[model samples]
Target: MSTTDSTATCECARAVAELREELATLRDEVAGLQRENAALRDANERKAERIETLETHVTQEFATIRERTDRIERVGYTAVGHAREHAQWMRKHDRLHDALKSRRERFDERLWDLETGEIDVQDVIDAGTNDLPIQTRTKERKTNPDALRGNKKRSTFIWPEFYARSRKTSGGNLIVTTPDAANILAEAGVKHDNETTKRAMRFVARLSGNRDDPNHEEHLIRFEPGERGKSPARLVADAGEFEQFAREASGMDVTDSENDETDTQDDSDDIVGAEADEQMDTLLNATTEGS
Candidate 1:
């Protein structure tokens, strides 16, 4: 009703209006925050679902991998077992082959002795000459006059003296009949007189076919002296003679057959032996490494 009272009323009205505006602003901020919180909660739920799906897929992949690994392990174990079995088989085969080879060797030696007089002389002869004849002076002259002219001829008188001085024929029992055998004997290159006779006796004994008779014991061929002191050519001739004698005595041709069989057996044994050795080495290495 006075001027001062009116001014106080006006101030109160302005304050009330300001307070209402501030409350309205606060309400709008609260509404915006609530909307943001609801959107965040939805996004979090979607992320949780995606994470669960990813975990399931990873678990399935791991299970598949584990299954495949188990199968591979089983296969590896089976392969190792098979390898061991094969190794054992190879060892057994090698042992049997060796035993059979030994038996075959003994049988061959006995059979060779039975068929021939004592040794497989045929093999020695076959190795030496191939059944070629020994070339003689007369044969050479007949075959090639130029060759005959180039070579010198010794006198018949010299032959007797040479024979007499030779150590091979002490009592004239050793004869140089075959031209080949005679050439072989002369070429032996014996220095000592006693050695010459001994060499001659050995040559003659090889030539003579009296191995079965015991009365010709002194005439028997001595391999040791000739084998030790003889030249390569003489040794070859002697070997040929022995081989010829063996072939004549033995009615069967066993050399080639025996060689073929021996080669086959050797190949088989080599393969088996190699496999067995590898297996043994593997086992030994494993043991050494504390496997």
Candidate 2:
């Protein structure tokens, strides 16, 4: 054979060997890529499952929250409704109380007139004393030897004036609001929000016995302490509490249990009533430190 033909045949065989080696390497790379792709696909499926679980949990939580909120709203609405109902009932109770009080007053007045031929001496005293215009009224001439100035005419309120006013104005079934009471005191030269009003309330704290029988001016005024700084005060009467307490304290109480009868406690200052200033002179006997 020729040398050129032999060399050509050798080159062809070498080229075939090189081509087969490259094809095997490509197959190995493809098999590795396929395994990696399968692993990635499995991981993606797990992540999808986790995402679905989270979504379900969030939905359930939202539903529970919505249910609880609805329940709270219902409870709030119920509470509001009950409060309104209670307010209405309270108003009704107040009206009934006023009607009954007026009727009782009328009956007492009638009975007293029939029994004694006139109004009670206390009423006469209250009316006569309270008639003075509040602006011009002065304190009763003091007889206190220890007082700094015994006869100095100063603006003050004592039991007599308050008793007189309260007696005269009570129970046309008058429900005196704090503003109304303040106005009454203002006419007597008292400031609406001053310490004098508080002092007057304290002075009358011992007068709770007025609830049982109209003696000792206990029933003349009942000071109710409520919402002291926040709202205007309201008046409330404790039925038998003050009367019972007074009985227990004195060890012996002289309450008028006698039937509709007028008794002149002191005829010296008769209920026929002289000048208001003169009547107050006799009031020295009623004065005390507690007052």
Number of the predicted model whose TM-score against the real structure is largest: 1
Model 2: per-residue Cα lDDT at residue 14: 93
Rate residue 119 of model 1 by lDDT: 32
TM-score of each: 0.33, 0.31
Give the per-residue lDDT digits (tens) of candidate 1, residues 109-223.
4465446443334424532432211112222322344432110111111122222232333443322332333443345331223444333333233323223211234322332
Clashing pairs in 2: 210-218, 210-219
Q: Which stretch of 10 consecutive residues in model 1 shows the poorest summed lDDT?
A: 149-158
Candidate 1, residue 100: the lDDT equals 89
Measured with C-alpha atoms, the lDDT of residue 223 in candidate 1 is 27
Q: Summing lDDT over every window of 10 consecutive residues in candidate 2, give the lowest-scoring window.
A: 131-140
After superposing candidate 2, which stretches have Cα over 4 Å from the reference?
Answer: 75-291
Compared with the true structure, model 1 gives a TM-score of 0.33
Model 1 CA deviation exceeding 4 Å by range: 1-7, 93-291
